[model samples]
Target: MKTKHHILTYALLALSISASAQYGSQKKADNLFNKFAFADATKIYHHLIEKNFNADFATRQLADSYAYMRNPDSATVYYKKAVQQDNVPIDYYYNYAQALRGIKEYKQSRLWLKRFKEAGGLIKKDRYLKDNDFLNSIFNAKHHYFLAPVNFNSKYSDFGAFEKDGTIYFASSRNLGTLKKHVYGWNHEPFLDLYTTAKRTDSIVNHKSKIKGDINSVYHDGPLTISKDGKTMYFSRNDFNKNVLGKDNQGVTHLNIYKATLVDGKWTNVEALGFNSNSYSNGHPALNNDDSRLYFTSDKPGGFGGSDIYYVDIKADGTFGTPQNLGNIINTNKNEMFPFINSENALFFSSDGHAGLGMLDIFATVTDDNNNIKSIINLGVPVNSSKDDFSFFMNKDGLSGFFASNRAGGIGGDDIYAYNRIPQLKIEGSITDATTNAPVPNAVVTLLDSNDNKIADLLTDENGHFEINIDRNTNYKLITQKDNYIDNSRTVSTKGIESSVTSIKANFVLNPVAKKEVPISELYPIYFDFNKYNIRSESTAELDRIVDLMVNKYPYMVIKIESHTDSRGSFAYNDKLSKERAKATYNYLVANGVNASRITEFNGYGERKLANGCDGTKNCTEAQHQLNRRTQFIVVKME
Candidate 1:
């Protein structure tokens, strides 16, 4: 993820500037923009643009207003115009790229990103320079998702989905009659409130309603977490009370996490967490499986990025411990938020700090026993896109769950989407020696798809057992090879597997290559026309098999190709023809990927080693003569 400064912070900065009489309308629009009042600011900026008053600046500000409002459609229009102006700031170009990505215009987004990088005044190196190929590879990669929009989405922002006990809890700005209606200036939408729905099916949901209580407030609320026991809950809300509205030095109110306990079937005792502060924002809380640790995102100072994921320990006496930053492995110089921990202790979060397709992408990482973050992996599209994606939640099964994305075709500004992971097929078996029927440990097994494209490579464990997951409804070939053994392969297909995870047995038995030479005729016969030196088409399959063995199985083995002829012509002429045939065989192997250096020699042995009595003086059937006129391969050296 490239570091694009948080546009919301810029809006706050704009509010701090004093108004000047010389630029009355412009100053007013700037003031509105700083207050996160994007809707009204948009109008003021648009009016100034119509009057042709500082049109370029108005255009950029207008775009910023829509962008911060999560309306990429309108933002792109003004951003496109703003970037055309001479000496436009590099951030504008980056903003334009994000807008393009929001609409699924990836190709155009990439082009704008190129221009952003070329402008070249970045403090942090562009991640795209190293991850463009990787990000692009996702389009062609196998994705198991079966994605669909949730049924209850409204035109307003609807996101932050979490499922517990067959009921789905989410945060949305949809208006309700019982709640006092107040619009958030950021998007001119009703302040967010927690809502719940019941799952009808894996892909369908029903019974949407806002939670009833003091939880619904005039200010923003929700994007919550429930304890495993379902008795306690932690949720995000603005730091505003009836008496006082908390504000930071920048005059921007921040979010805080509050805890509420279920008493007599009602959520009560809502209190802010001890660690929350007015000086910095903290929200989007998630608890570990046992609720011993709480994870949340914050823009607190001394953090590595704009917002970073942090966790605090919950003691036995219900006391809190010092918050700990997840560190660089999970946090970067850009925002990382919306942390979710699955059953496997793998942490999933959204980050704009890693290399991704576009704006914030969802990433997952596992931690060791010491609770240190390890490698991080992108969820990839269609789970992730060029638009802001966050608030990921899934079950222990890893088969299905919900996430939020502002990608195109969504039902609202940021819609909650349900996804089911298609069933995966597995191929599992053991490798053994043909002679002894004993496990062959450490044998290399390679998997290839129908097109002979390599899929995966594995080594047999001490028990000679190996198991690997493969794509469903695909044909595959498994090649098993080991030192001093003849390689073998088996074809397997999962075209009809219907289970969530189907495991099919596919065993391999490899023969040990004898100390003496092994004849190629034992594997497959090679036939030729009476006087032809060119390879026959029927022999290609067998020849390719040999090539695969030499390249993958016996890298240190050298081979010798022997071509012979029946005692029909003069020895000199027969020898010359035999040599040509042997050379043709050798060339085919080399062209098919077997290294030329691996072939020790190819020689003609005309009538010297006849398979049967087929001498020129004696009359013999054509079958007997054909047996004498043949090509053979043997291992000349093995090291």
Candidate 2:
């Protein structure tokens, strides 16, 4: 039987090897993939993968093909499969993470990125894994921006919005149908073209139409920057001349910057800038306020990573200087593109290298007098999301702006989003004694929203003052607490406060707790067993209540503990035991939080102050004897 089983196993193993060999050769798939024919390459890879022939490599290649083709949904499946196989490459982990993020699987993407980092030999692990305050600000910050998609978005990718003079100019891949549209192999979408629409109102934009003149070319064009004077325009376009596409040594056509002059109400004199390159992409032009500096993104030699922001001086003679990289402080080993400068001299750009919420997040960097980066701030959400967010543009007021995002629930592949900042509300208050109207320093003042969630807590200064910023159109509760005083609370609302500096005064008056004299009989009694001085757990509740009353409610009150015992033992023995019991009660209160000095005295009177006839030789019930063996508190003094 054993020999027959071994023969069957051998035959099965051979059959499996023969079946795996039936899958087609790997060379065929590589040939089509190298030619950028990803659609056809994936078919052969899928067939080989079904037969489990070179499954790991086939899965990774299939994922890479769909990823290069900009189909993250399809790529995610293969990438997931590739990652499950043993000894997968490190790059496969990163690609899987990016693919997961493209589909809004944020938590899963982070897991893969963590795995990618742990695989060792990563050059930018520290840069990518560092904790970022800007990334955290997205979750803890108050909702200040309201974002919504614009009306002109189409089914294709539409982004890179810039508003100039009453007209909104942006880039889109929507085919106009008048000309033979060229589809980009990357996403299989029509080439990007510049379109313009009039800003009908602050929130609404009119129907978009193709931009006039030679600006809209047969190939990719747009993401333009207009000079302050509105007479000059600088735009990005593919390296195309007279319907002929230019290619570099790697056969990749790069983007170029072109400048045009407005002649007789029409954009004319269009010419490629001197910095235009055929080897590397340089596009997304942005001009400074005075037009003295032109900022753009490039993948040129010596960049930190995929794409970096670079600027060239537009000299007095209108000639361009050599492009200067923004340095490693702003650029990283990953891509950073879509540079925009605001009136404040702050540069806003999108980067995937920085520690972020997952994918490309928008960041703002400001430079000091020496042109060194002072600080980099992430724009955070809802201006940014796990998906790609870039091309930020704002008006002079800074209260509103437009940007681009490929996050879910958008109107197109990448939609233009408008945001408006909501005004902030301020709350300030004073904490004072109710009877004397004196400032109560060191009092805790806390603010909570309508859901009873604590918003902020601050201690009152010497002047009994506290201040905090709050959100508008919300209800809140202000609570004040202090030692030796009753806690006070007030409900306040900023629902109707519309002004930018609306300050609400919420003064708190806490009443001091009065001293009270109570016999230990009224308060829960501390009883002792025969000949015992140890404190009991059942008596702790009443003892702690007195501690709280003395330490917190009546800080100036002094307490006197008195102890008594039954007459069963000798007079001298009972007296000593009563005193020990009194000392035990006093020590417990002091140890629990009551100040030692507040305990004015502790004394015992054994059998001398018996409450009933059970004293000495009298017959008594257990309850009657227990009542005589009790500890009591007396109000000695109140400062």
**Tens-place lDDT digits, model 2, residues 1-639:** 012111111100001433313222455676555433456678888887786655567788899887766678989998988888655657788789778877988888888878877886243443334433334335654566677547777778777788888888888888655556687766677878887888623332322377777787767887888999999999888887667788889786778888988887677788889888788777889987689999988878898867788899999999989899988878898777788887655678887888778677788764433545644657777887878777888776555678887788986777788877654457888988988999987787777777765554556767787766665777999888776776678899987776555478999898775545433344466888878888888888889888887877777877668899987889878888999999999989988988887775687888788878886566789888988888988765556
After the best TM-score superposition of candidate 1, give how far the Cα of residue 638 lies from its true spot, in angstroms. 41
Q: Estimate the overall C-alpha local distance difference test score of candidate 1.
A: 0.75
**Candidate that scores best on TM-score:** 1
- What tens-digit string does per-residue lDDT give for candidate 1 at 448-468? 877765555666777788776
* lDDT over C-alpha atoms for residue 535 of model 2: 86
- Candidate 2 global lDDT: 0.74
How far out, in Å, is residue 409 in model 1?
A: 1.5
Give the poorly placed runs of model 1, Cα more than 4 Å off. Answer: 1-133, 176-180, 200-208, 241-244, 249-251, 366-369, 427-470, 476-492, 496-639
Mark the 10 consecutive residues where model 2 has the least summed lDDT.
6-15
Candidates' RMSD to native: 21.2, 23.3
Model 2: residues with Cα > 4 Å off, grouped in runs? 1-137, 177-179, 200-208, 242-244, 424-493, 498-639
